[model samples]
Target chain A: NAGVTQTPKFRVLKTGQSMTLLCAQDMNHEYMYWYRQDPGMGLRLIHYSVGEGTTAKGEVPDGYNVSRLKKQNFLLGLESAAPSQTSVYFCASSYPGSQGKETQYFGPGTRLLVL
Target chain B: AQSVAQPEDQVNVAEGNPLTVKCTYSVSGNPYLFWYVQYPNRGLQFLLKYITGDNLVKGSYGFEAEFNKSQTSFHLKKPSALVSDSALYFCAVRDSSTPGYSSASKIIFGSGTRLSIRP
Candidate 1:
Protein backbone atom coordinates (compact mmCIF):
# COMPACT_ATOMS: atom_id res chain seq x y z
CA ASN A 1 0.00 0.00 0.00
CA ALA A 2 3.02 2.27 0.10
CA GLY A 3 1.85 3.37 3.54
CA VAL A 4 4.09 6.45 3.42
CA THR A 5 6.71 7.73 0.93
CA GLN A 6 9.20 10.56 0.96
CA THR A 7 10.77 12.26 -2.02
CA PRO A 8 14.49 13.06 -2.48
CA LYS A 9 15.59 10.41 0.00
CA PHE A 10 18.97 12.10 0.17
CA ARG A 11 19.95 15.70 -0.52
CA VAL A 12 22.91 18.01 -0.14
CA LEU A 13 22.47 21.76 0.10
CA LYS A 14 24.79 24.74 0.40
CA THR A 15 24.27 27.42 2.97
CA GLY A 16 21.37 29.78 2.16
CA GLN A 17 19.97 27.31 -0.39
CA SER A 18 16.29 26.46 -0.25
CA MET A 19 14.53 23.16 -0.79
CA THR A 20 11.36 21.27 -0.05
CA LEU A 21 10.83 17.72 1.22
CA LEU A 22 7.63 16.02 0.12
CA CYS A 23 5.70 13.34 2.02
CA ALA A 24 2.78 11.34 0.70
CA GLN A 25 0.57 8.70 2.25
CA ASP A 26 -2.19 6.54 0.77
CA MET A 27 -3.71 5.44 4.07
CA ASN A 28 -6.31 8.23 4.06
CA HIS A 29 -5.21 9.28 7.50
CA GLU A 30 -6.38 12.59 8.93
CA TYR A 31 -3.18 13.48 10.72
CA MET A 32 0.28 14.10 9.24
CA TYR A 33 3.52 15.03 10.99
CA TRP A 34 7.11 16.11 10.24
CA TYR A 35 9.98 15.24 12.54
CA ARG A 36 13.76 15.42 12.57
CA GLN A 37 16.07 12.93 14.25
CA ASP A 38 19.46 13.98 15.55
CA PRO A 39 22.14 12.23 17.56
CA GLY A 40 21.40 12.23 21.29
CA MET A 41 18.43 14.56 20.65
CA GLY A 42 16.06 11.81 19.63
CA LEU A 43 13.13 12.78 17.41
CA ARG A 44 11.74 16.28 17.62
CA LEU A 45 8.54 17.34 15.91
CA ILE A 46 8.97 20.03 13.29
CA HIS A 47 5.36 20.59 12.25
CA TYR A 48 2.08 18.72 12.01
CA SER A 49 -1.34 18.94 10.39
CA VAL A 50 -4.59 17.59 11.72
CA GLY A 51 -6.43 17.94 8.42
CA GLU A 52 -5.89 19.05 4.83
CA GLY A 53 -5.90 22.76 5.56
CA THR A 54 -4.80 22.94 9.17
CA THR A 55 -1.16 23.09 10.25
CA ALA A 56 0.41 23.52 13.66
CA LYS A 57 3.88 24.14 15.09
CA GLY A 58 5.64 21.31 16.90
CA GLU A 59 8.51 21.05 19.35
CA VAL A 60 11.10 22.42 16.91
CA PRO A 61 9.60 24.40 14.03
CA ASP A 62 11.86 27.41 13.83
CA GLY A 63 13.74 26.69 10.59
CA TYR A 64 10.94 25.09 8.64
CA ASN A 65 7.50 25.73 7.16
CA VAL A 66 4.87 23.20 6.22
CA SER A 67 1.86 23.14 3.88
CA ARG A 68 -1.01 20.67 3.71
CA LEU A 69 -2.61 21.75 0.47
CA LYS A 70 -3.78 18.19 -0.20
CA LYS A 71 -5.00 15.46 2.11
CA GLN A 72 -2.48 12.89 0.94
CA ASN A 73 0.50 15.20 0.85
CA PHE A 74 2.46 17.24 3.38
CA LEU A 75 5.42 19.42 2.34
CA LEU A 76 8.22 20.83 4.47
CA GLY A 77 10.18 23.79 3.14
CA LEU A 78 13.41 25.27 4.27
CA GLU A 79 13.67 28.86 3.13
CA SER A 80 17.39 28.90 3.88
CA ALA A 81 19.31 25.83 4.80
CA ALA A 82 21.95 25.85 7.52
CA PRO A 83 24.36 23.36 9.00
CA SER A 84 22.25 23.24 12.11
CA GLN A 85 19.36 22.00 9.99
CA THR A 86 21.23 18.95 8.77
CA SER A 87 19.48 15.85 10.03
CA VAL A 88 17.36 12.88 9.03
CA TYR A 89 13.77 13.92 8.47
CA PHE A 90 10.83 11.57 8.89
CA CYS A 91 7.17 11.90 7.98
CA ALA A 92 4.40 10.14 9.88
CA SER A 93 0.61 9.85 9.70
CA SER A 94 -2.12 8.46 11.93
CA TYR A 95 -5.87 8.31 12.44
CA PRO A 96 -7.69 11.05 14.29
CA GLY A 97 -7.71 11.08 18.10
CA SER A 98 -5.11 11.50 20.81
CA GLN A 99 -1.72 10.75 19.21
CA GLY A 100 -0.52 8.45 21.97
CA LYS A 101 -3.61 6.31 21.64
CA GLU A 102 -3.11 5.76 17.89
CA THR A 103 -0.47 4.10 15.75
CA GLN A 104 1.70 6.41 13.63
CA TYR A 105 3.13 5.00 10.43
CA PHE A 106 6.45 6.59 9.41
CA GLY A 107 8.11 7.00 6.04
CA PRO A 108 11.60 5.84 5.08
CA GLY A 109 13.06 9.23 5.98
CA THR A 110 15.19 11.78 4.05
CA ARG A 111 18.79 12.47 4.89
CA LEU A 112 19.64 16.14 4.37
CA LEU A 113 23.14 17.50 4.67
CA VAL A 114 23.64 21.26 4.66
CA LEU A 115 27.18 22.42 4.09
CA ALA B 1 2.95 19.10 29.54
CA GLN B 2 3.46 15.44 28.74
CA SER B 3 6.93 13.92 28.74
CA VAL B 4 8.69 10.54 28.48
CA ALA B 5 12.02 9.38 29.84
CA GLN B 6 14.24 6.43 29.00
CA PRO B 7 16.83 6.39 31.74
CA GLU B 8 19.26 4.08 30.01
CA ASP B 9 21.22 5.29 27.03
CA GLN B 10 22.21 1.76 26.08
CA VAL B 11 21.28 -1.76 27.13
CA ASN B 12 23.34 -4.86 26.44
CA VAL B 13 22.20 -8.48 26.64
CA ALA B 14 23.24 -11.88 25.31
CA GLU B 15 21.10 -13.84 22.93
CA GLY B 16 18.67 -16.20 24.67
CA ASN B 17 18.74 -14.03 27.76
CA PRO B 18 16.03 -11.84 29.17
CA LEU B 19 16.19 -8.13 28.43
CA THR B 20 14.58 -5.01 29.78
CA VAL B 21 14.48 -1.38 28.61
CA LYS B 22 13.20 1.07 31.20
CA CYS B 23 10.73 3.86 30.51
CA THR B 24 8.91 6.39 32.67
CA TYR B 25 6.29 9.03 31.88
CA SER B 26 4.58 12.09 33.25
CA VAL B 27 1.21 13.52 32.19
CA SER B 28 -1.62 15.52 33.67
CA GLY B 29 -4.36 12.91 33.35
CA ASN B 30 -4.43 9.32 32.23
CA PRO B 31 -1.49 8.56 29.96
CA TYR B 32 -1.36 6.58 26.73
CA LEU B 33 2.07 5.01 26.29
CA PHE B 34 3.83 3.67 23.21
CA TRP B 35 7.04 1.91 22.15
CA TYR B 36 8.82 2.15 18.80
CA VAL B 37 11.93 0.49 17.35
CA GLN B 38 14.28 1.86 14.72
CA TYR B 39 16.91 0.09 12.71
CA PRO B 40 20.01 1.68 11.25
CA ASN B 41 19.08 4.55 8.90
CA ARG B 42 15.39 3.66 8.91
CA GLY B 43 12.20 5.18 10.19
CA LEU B 44 10.71 4.28 13.55
CA GLN B 45 8.48 1.19 13.65
CA PHE B 46 5.52 0.88 15.98
CA LEU B 47 6.09 -1.93 18.47
CA LEU B 48 3.19 -1.65 20.91
CA LYS B 49 0.94 0.71 22.82
CA TYR B 50 -0.99 0.94 26.08
CA ILE B 51 -4.29 2.74 25.95
CA THR B 52 -6.74 1.17 28.38
CA GLY B 53 -6.45 -2.49 29.24
CA ASP B 54 -4.29 -5.02 31.00
CA ASN B 55 -0.95 -3.84 32.36
CA LEU B 56 0.89 -6.49 30.35
CA VAL B 57 0.70 -5.61 26.65
CA LYS B 58 2.17 -8.01 24.12
CA GLY B 59 3.40 -6.83 20.76
CA SER B 60 5.21 -7.96 17.64
CA TYR B 61 8.40 -10.08 17.76
CA GLY B 62 7.46 -11.56 21.11
CA PHE B 63 8.01 -8.20 22.79
CA GLU B 64 5.91 -7.03 25.73
CA ALA B 65 5.72 -4.10 28.09
CA GLU B 66 4.41 -3.86 31.62
CA PHE B 67 2.50 -0.72 32.58
CA ASN B 68 2.81 0.29 36.21
CA LYS B 69 0.38 3.12 36.91
CA SER B 70 1.50 3.64 40.43
CA GLN B 71 5.14 3.99 39.42
CA THR B 72 4.30 5.77 36.14
CA SER B 73 6.47 3.39 34.18
CA PHE B 74 6.07 1.23 31.08
CA HIS B 75 9.13 -1.01 30.73
CA LEU B 76 9.65 -3.11 27.62
CA LYS B 77 10.67 -6.72 28.18
CA LYS B 78 11.46 -9.87 26.23
CA PRO B 79 12.02 -13.32 27.64
CA SER B 80 14.64 -14.35 25.10
CA ALA B 81 16.60 -11.71 23.29
CA LEU B 82 17.77 -12.18 19.73
CA VAL B 83 20.77 -10.71 17.93
CA SER B 84 18.41 -9.17 15.40
CA ASP B 85 16.74 -7.27 18.20
CA SER B 86 19.64 -4.86 18.39
CA ALA B 87 18.33 -1.41 17.51
CA LEU B 88 17.20 1.91 18.89
CA TYR B 89 14.11 1.95 21.09
CA PHE B 90 11.96 4.92 21.98
CA CYS B 91 9.29 5.51 24.61
CA ALA B 92 6.48 7.98 24.12
CA VAL B 93 3.48 9.25 26.10
CA ARG B 94 0.43 11.48 25.73
CA ASP B 95 -2.32 12.69 27.99
CA SER B 96 -5.80 11.14 27.65
CA SER B 97 -7.84 13.89 29.27
CA THR B 98 -10.54 15.39 27.12
CA PRO B 99 -9.71 18.90 28.29
CA GLY B 100 -6.10 18.47 27.15
CA TYR B 101 -6.80 16.86 23.78
CA SER B 102 -5.24 19.75 21.92
CA SER B 103 -1.93 19.40 23.67
CA ALA B 104 -2.39 15.70 24.21
CA SER B 105 -2.56 15.16 20.50
CA LYS B 106 1.19 15.56 20.52
CA ILE B 107 3.25 12.53 21.50
CA ILE B 108 6.37 13.33 23.49
CA PHE B 109 9.24 10.91 22.85
CA GLY B 110 12.11 9.99 25.10
CA SER B 111 15.80 10.30 24.22
CA GLY B 112 15.86 6.66 23.10
CA THR B 113 17.88 3.63 24.24
CA ARG B 114 20.16 1.57 22.05
CA LEU B 115 19.63 -2.16 22.54
CA SER B 116 22.51 -4.46 21.61
CA ILE B 117 21.84 -8.17 21.82
CA ARG B 118 25.08 -10.07 21.35
CA PRO B 119 25.11 -13.44 19.64
Candidate 2:
Protein backbone atom coordinates (compact mmCIF):
# COMPACT_ATOMS: atom_id res chain seq x y z
CA ASN A 1 0.00 0.00 0.00
CA ALA A 2 1.21 3.50 -0.82
CA GLY A 3 0.73 4.76 2.73
CA VAL A 4 0.89 8.38 1.61
CA THR A 5 1.86 10.02 -1.68
CA GLN A 6 2.41 13.66 -2.61
CA THR A 7 2.43 15.16 -6.10
CA PRO A 8 5.15 17.34 -7.69
CA LYS A 9 7.89 16.10 -5.36
CA PHE A 10 9.76 19.26 -6.29
CA ARG A 11 8.57 22.59 -7.59
CA VAL A 12 9.98 26.03 -8.30
CA LEU A 13 7.75 29.10 -8.39
CA LYS A 14 8.40 32.77 -8.98
CA THR A 15 7.00 35.30 -6.55
CA GLY A 16 3.20 35.74 -6.73
CA GLN A 17 2.78 32.42 -8.53
CA SER A 18 0.10 30.07 -7.23
CA MET A 19 0.12 26.32 -6.99
CA THR A 20 -1.47 23.41 -5.20
CA LEU A 21 0.19 20.40 -3.56
CA LEU A 22 -1.85 17.24 -3.55
CA CYS A 23 -1.65 14.47 -0.94
CA ALA A 24 -3.28 11.08 -1.17
CA GLN A 25 -3.29 8.13 1.17
CA ASP A 26 -4.33 4.59 0.54
CA MET A 27 -5.05 3.96 4.20
CA ASN A 28 -8.58 4.82 5.18
CA HIS A 29 -7.49 7.28 7.82
CA GLU A 30 -9.88 9.93 9.06
CA TYR A 31 -7.27 12.60 9.76
CA MET A 32 -4.99 14.30 7.22
CA TYR A 33 -2.50 17.09 7.88
CA TRP A 34 -0.19 19.50 6.06
CA TYR A 35 3.05 20.68 7.63
CA ARG A 36 6.10 22.66 6.58
CA GLN A 37 9.61 21.97 7.89
CA ASP A 38 12.07 24.79 8.22
CA PRO A 39 15.78 24.93 9.06
CA GLY A 40 15.74 24.89 12.85
CA MET A 41 12.06 25.34 13.52
CA GLY A 42 10.36 21.98 13.69
CA LEU A 43 7.47 21.04 11.51
CA ARG A 44 4.56 23.45 11.91
CA LEU A 45 1.02 22.51 11.06
CA ILE A 46 -0.32 24.40 8.04
CA HIS A 47 -3.84 22.98 7.92
CA TYR A 48 -5.70 19.82 8.66
CA SER A 49 -8.86 17.94 7.74
CA VAL A 50 -10.47 15.49 10.09
CA GLY A 51 -12.89 13.98 7.66
CA GLU A 52 -13.88 14.20 4.05
CA GLY A 53 -15.76 17.49 4.42
CA THR A 54 -14.22 19.21 7.44
CA THR A 55 -11.16 21.41 7.56
CA ALA A 56 -9.47 23.41 10.32
CA LYS A 57 -6.80 26.06 10.75
CA GLY A 58 -3.54 25.05 12.35
CA GLU A 59 -0.57 26.76 13.94
CA VAL A 60 0.66 28.30 10.70
CA PRO A 61 -2.31 28.53 8.35
CA ASP A 62 -1.62 32.00 7.07
CA GLY A 63 -0.28 31.59 3.53
CA TYR A 64 -2.22 28.48 2.66
CA ASN A 65 -5.63 26.92 2.22
CA VAL A 66 -6.71 23.30 2.33
CA SER A 67 -9.59 21.21 1.04
CA ARG A 68 -10.70 17.67 1.73
CA LEU A 69 -13.08 16.76 -1.05
CA LYS A 70 -12.44 13.03 -0.71
CA LYS A 71 -11.55 10.81 2.21
CA GLN A 72 -8.28 9.77 0.56
CA ASN A 73 -7.12 13.19 -0.56
CA PHE A 74 -6.05 16.47 1.06
CA LEU A 75 -4.89 19.45 -0.93
CA LEU A 76 -2.85 22.45 0.17
CA GLY A 77 -2.91 25.57 -1.98
CA LEU A 78 -0.74 28.62 -1.97
CA GLU A 79 -2.56 31.60 -3.46
CA SER A 80 0.65 33.55 -3.96
CA ALA A 81 3.99 31.99 -3.27
CA ALA A 82 6.68 33.91 -1.47
CA PRO A 83 10.29 33.35 -0.52
CA SER A 84 9.22 32.99 3.08
CA GLN A 85 7.02 30.08 2.05
CA THR A 86 9.89 28.15 0.53
CA SER A 87 10.26 24.97 2.53
CA VAL A 88 9.76 21.24 2.47
CA TYR A 89 6.09 20.39 2.79
CA PHE A 90 4.87 17.15 4.27
CA CYS A 91 1.54 15.34 4.20
CA ALA A 92 0.44 12.96 6.88
CA SER A 93 -2.62 10.93 7.93
CA SER A 94 -3.77 9.05 10.95
CA TYR A 95 -6.73 7.24 12.39
CA PRO A 96 -9.14 9.14 14.66
CA GLY A 97 -9.03 8.18 18.32
CA SER A 98 -8.08 9.32 21.79
CA GLN A 99 -5.96 6.26 22.27
CA GLY A 100 -2.35 5.97 21.21
CA LYS A 101 -3.24 3.96 18.14
CA GLU A 102 -3.51 7.06 15.97
CA THR A 103 0.05 7.16 14.66
CA GLN A 104 0.47 9.50 11.72
CA TYR A 105 2.03 8.15 8.53
CA PHE A 106 3.92 10.67 6.42
CA GLY A 107 4.80 11.02 2.75
CA PRO A 108 8.31 11.65 1.46
CA GLY A 109 7.80 15.42 1.13
CA THR A 110 7.55 18.15 -1.49
CA ARG A 111 10.36 20.66 -1.80
CA LEU A 112 9.07 24.08 -2.80
CA LEU A 113 11.37 26.89 -3.82
CA VAL A 114 9.84 30.32 -4.31
CA LEU A 115 12.12 32.79 -5.99
CA ALA B 1 -1.83 24.78 25.17
CA GLN B 2 0.49 21.83 24.59
CA SER B 3 4.19 22.18 23.91
CA VAL B 4 7.26 19.97 23.59
CA ALA B 5 10.96 20.75 23.80
CA GLN B 6 14.21 19.05 22.90
CA PRO B 7 16.89 20.77 24.91
CA GLU B 8 19.88 19.57 22.91
CA ASP B 9 20.42 20.72 19.38
CA GLN B 10 23.14 18.14 18.83
CA VAL B 11 24.12 15.00 20.67
CA ASN B 12 27.33 13.05 19.96
CA VAL B 13 27.86 9.53 21.24
CA ALA B 14 30.64 7.05 20.62
CA GLU B 15 29.73 3.83 18.93
CA GLY B 16 28.62 1.11 21.42
CA ASN B 17 27.80 3.63 24.09
CA PRO B 18 24.31 4.24 25.34
CA LEU B 19 22.59 7.26 23.85
CA THR B 20 19.95 9.56 25.22
CA VAL B 21 18.15 12.41 23.47
CA LYS B 22 16.20 14.55 25.91
CA CYS B 23 12.61 15.65 25.45
CA THR B 24 10.19 17.41 27.81
CA TYR B 25 6.56 18.30 27.42
CA SER B 26 3.76 20.28 29.00
CA VAL B 27 0.09 19.73 28.36
CA SER B 28 -3.23 20.61 29.94
CA GLY B 29 -4.25 16.99 30.29
CA ASN B 30 -2.59 13.59 30.00
CA PRO B 31 0.19 13.90 27.44
CA TYR B 32 0.17 11.75 24.33
CA LEU B 33 3.87 11.74 23.65
CA PHE B 34 5.66 10.59 20.48
CA TRP B 35 9.14 10.28 19.00
CA TYR B 36 10.05 10.56 15.32
CA VAL B 37 13.29 10.40 13.38
CA GLN B 38 14.11 12.22 10.16
CA TYR B 39 16.92 11.28 7.86
CA PRO B 40 18.77 13.71 5.56
CA ASN B 41 15.82 14.86 3.45
CA ARG B 42 13.13 12.40 4.35
CA GLY B 43 9.88 12.85 6.18
CA LEU B 44 9.62 12.11 9.87
CA GLN B 45 9.30 8.45 10.79
CA PHE B 46 7.40 7.37 13.87
CA LEU B 47 9.66 5.72 16.40
CA LEU B 48 7.55 5.13 19.48
CA LYS B 49 4.85 6.61 21.67
CA TYR B 50 3.78 6.70 25.29
CA ILE B 51 0.05 6.32 25.88
CA THR B 52 -1.07 5.06 29.27
CA GLY B 53 0.33 1.77 30.39
CA ASP B 54 4.09 1.70 30.33
CA ASN B 55 6.52 4.33 31.45
CA LEU B 56 9.15 2.79 29.16
CA VAL B 57 7.93 2.35 25.62
CA LYS B 58 10.02 0.33 23.16
CA GLY B 59 9.81 1.12 19.49
CA SER B 60 11.29 0.23 16.13
CA TYR B 61 15.04 -0.02 15.54
CA GLY B 62 15.71 -0.94 19.17
CA PHE B 63 14.90 2.53 20.42
CA GLU B 64 12.96 3.22 23.62
CA ALA B 65 11.74 6.20 25.61
CA GLU B 66 10.89 6.61 29.26
CA PHE B 67 7.97 8.80 30.19
CA ASN B 68 8.35 10.58 33.50
CA LYS B 69 5.32 12.48 34.66
CA SER B 70 7.10 14.09 37.57
CA GLN B 71 9.80 15.49 35.34
CA THR B 72 7.52 16.01 32.35
CA SER B 73 10.14 14.28 30.19
CA PHE B 74 10.09 11.48 27.63
CA HIS B 75 13.75 10.99 26.74
CA LEU B 76 14.57 8.61 23.90
CA LYS B 77 17.17 5.98 24.70
CA LYS B 78 19.11 3.28 22.95
CA PRO B 79 21.26 0.71 24.71
CA SER B 80 23.96 0.77 22.07
CA ALA B 81 24.62 3.42 19.51
CA LEU B 82 25.30 2.65 15.88
CA VAL B 83 26.54 4.83 13.06
CA SER B 84 23.32 4.18 11.21
CA ASP B 85 21.39 5.63 14.15
CA SER B 86 22.58 9.13 13.46
CA ALA B 87 19.71 11.34 12.42
CA LEU B 88 17.41 14.12 13.55
CA TYR B 89 14.97 13.27 16.29
CA PHE B 90 11.78 15.08 17.25
CA CYS B 91 9.43 14.97 20.19
CA ALA B 92 5.75 15.72 19.85
CA VAL B 93 2.82 15.92 22.21
CA ARG B 94 -0.93 16.43 22.15
CA ASP B 95 -3.44 17.11 24.88
CA SER B 96 -5.41 13.98 25.60
CA SER B 97 -8.22 16.06 27.06
CA THR B 98 -9.12 17.19 23.58
CA PRO B 99 -12.28 15.35 22.68
CA GLY B 100 -11.76 12.39 20.42
CA TYR B 101 -14.72 13.40 18.31
CA SER B 102 -13.15 16.69 17.35
CA SER B 103 -11.91 16.71 13.75
CA ALA B 104 -9.45 19.48 14.42
CA SER B 105 -6.72 17.73 16.31
CA LYS B 106 -3.37 19.45 16.77
CA ILE B 107 0.02 18.19 17.83
CA ILE B 108 3.00 20.34 18.85
CA PHE B 109 6.55 19.27 17.97
CA GLY B 110 9.89 20.14 19.50
CA SER B 111 12.52 21.94 17.51
CA GLY B 112 14.57 18.76 17.00
CA THR B 113 17.70 16.95 18.18
CA ARG B 114 20.53 15.97 15.87
CA LEU B 115 22.07 12.71 17.01
CA SER B 116 25.52 11.66 15.78
CA ILE B 117 26.90 8.25 16.58
CA ARG B 118 30.64 8.07 16.02
CA PRO B 119 32.84 5.10 15.36
TM-score of predicted chain A against the true chain A, for each candidate: 0.97, 0.96
lDDT of model number 1: 0.92
What DockQ does candidate 2 have relative to the true complex? 0.60
Worst ten in a row by lDDT for model 1 chain A: A95-104
Docking class of 2: medium
RMSD for each of the candidates: 1.4, 1.3
Instruction: Please give, for residues B1-119, the per-residue lDDT of candidate 1 as tens digits.
Output: 67889999999999999999999999989988889999987899999999998999999999999999999999999999999999999998878874532552468889999999999
List DockQ, one per candidate, in order: 0.61, 0.60
Q: Residue-wise lDDT of candidate 1 within A21-110, one digit each (tens)?
A: 999999999889999999887889999998899899988999899999999999999999999999999999998764557789999999
In model 1, the runs with Cα more than 4 Å from the true position are: A97-100, B98-105
Evaluated at residue B66, the lDDT of candidate 1 is 99
